[model samples]
Target: MESLIAAVREQDEAARFLVWPGDFDLDRGDHVEEVHLASGATLEGFAGDGAGGTYFFCGEGGEERPILYADSEGGAAPVAIGLPELLRLLLVVPWWRDCQAFTAEESRELAAEYLEDMPDLPARRDRAAAALGIDLPAQADVLARLREVAVRMGEDFVLVLTPEGHPYEPLFTN
Candidate 1:
């Protein structure tokens, strides 16, 4: 399964790709949406660049999840698609002006840290922005946008709780 995702990522020529398994089958939209809702997220499609060929849609549970068939070809393997990188690609790319440039781990750490400290979603987002060194007044919108991206990325954003009920880390691995 990892190999398959690796193959996709190894291509490295896709302009944009989504990692949602539910987005693949139009019929399963509701099911995926239900799962997303249960996880406190909503599923929606975001536009991607026309270049770089295809958009890879990796589904839940790593390579076991259905990979979306794209009109074009080329992209990182599903497994290789780092959560932070994926979030940056999906959420930040659209808001290029307010987004910060950071590696996947940095993004994940910042987002997690902000969420942990702030607890409140809005406040957490503000901290996220500050952590990223952004001063956009529209931080609320960015938070909402990031939430949508998190839901879309599913397992990647599933926070694991410690014995004391604190978010210890993301549940899934890339």
Candidate 2:
């Protein structure tokens, strides 16, 4: 997780857009640690938060971590895998879901472009969807909605989480 964070920090685009929670001293039992304790899932790192909830990347380590979204309701759902995949989804899914910015064909093309070089992307996507207890079709629907929400809110917008799973809106410029 530390390595991933470092890599992200080095990238101007990712660092600029993917807000990190470590910036604020929120008394929320440590976001990654708490989630690890609660679910027995090892925290690889955190992605960001949204109106939907706080999102995290968890796994033992390596190139395939499952992205999870946890909310104030004490519920968590796996959304995607790997930092790259999650970022791609964040960029394209919402636009696809809204159906206002891109057509289905365009959405697929965009997703493909963003997901280029990802080996076995379909399988990874399926694993994430299954972890969330969603079927294939439903998974697609959720991604669309998730994408819509994330993009409309702003690429850099992230809500910091309290130890109790409550979210605090953090001010983000650009």
Best by lDDT: 2
lDDT of 2 by residue, 1-174 (tens): 455445544554434333321111111223443444244446544443433345655647664665555554444444455555555554335333223333456566655754675544555544443433334443355455444444443222233343565433322111
Please provide TM-scores, in order, for all candidate models, with all chains considered together: 0.21, 0.40
Cα deviation at 77, candidate 2, in Å, is 0.8
Candidate 2 is scored at a TM of 0.40
Flag clash pairs in model 1: 5-77, 5-78, 8-76, 8-77, 9-76, 9-77, 21-59
lDDT of 1 by residue, 1-174 (tens): 234333334432221122221012222222111112123332222222333222234434432232221122211112113333333333333322122332344445554654575355444333443443334433344444444443345444332222333332321222
Which candidate ranks first by TM-score, i.e. highest?
A: 2
Q: Candidate 2: give the clashing pairs.
A: 28-163, 93-147, 94-147, 94-148
Candidate 2, residue 166: the lDDT equals: 45
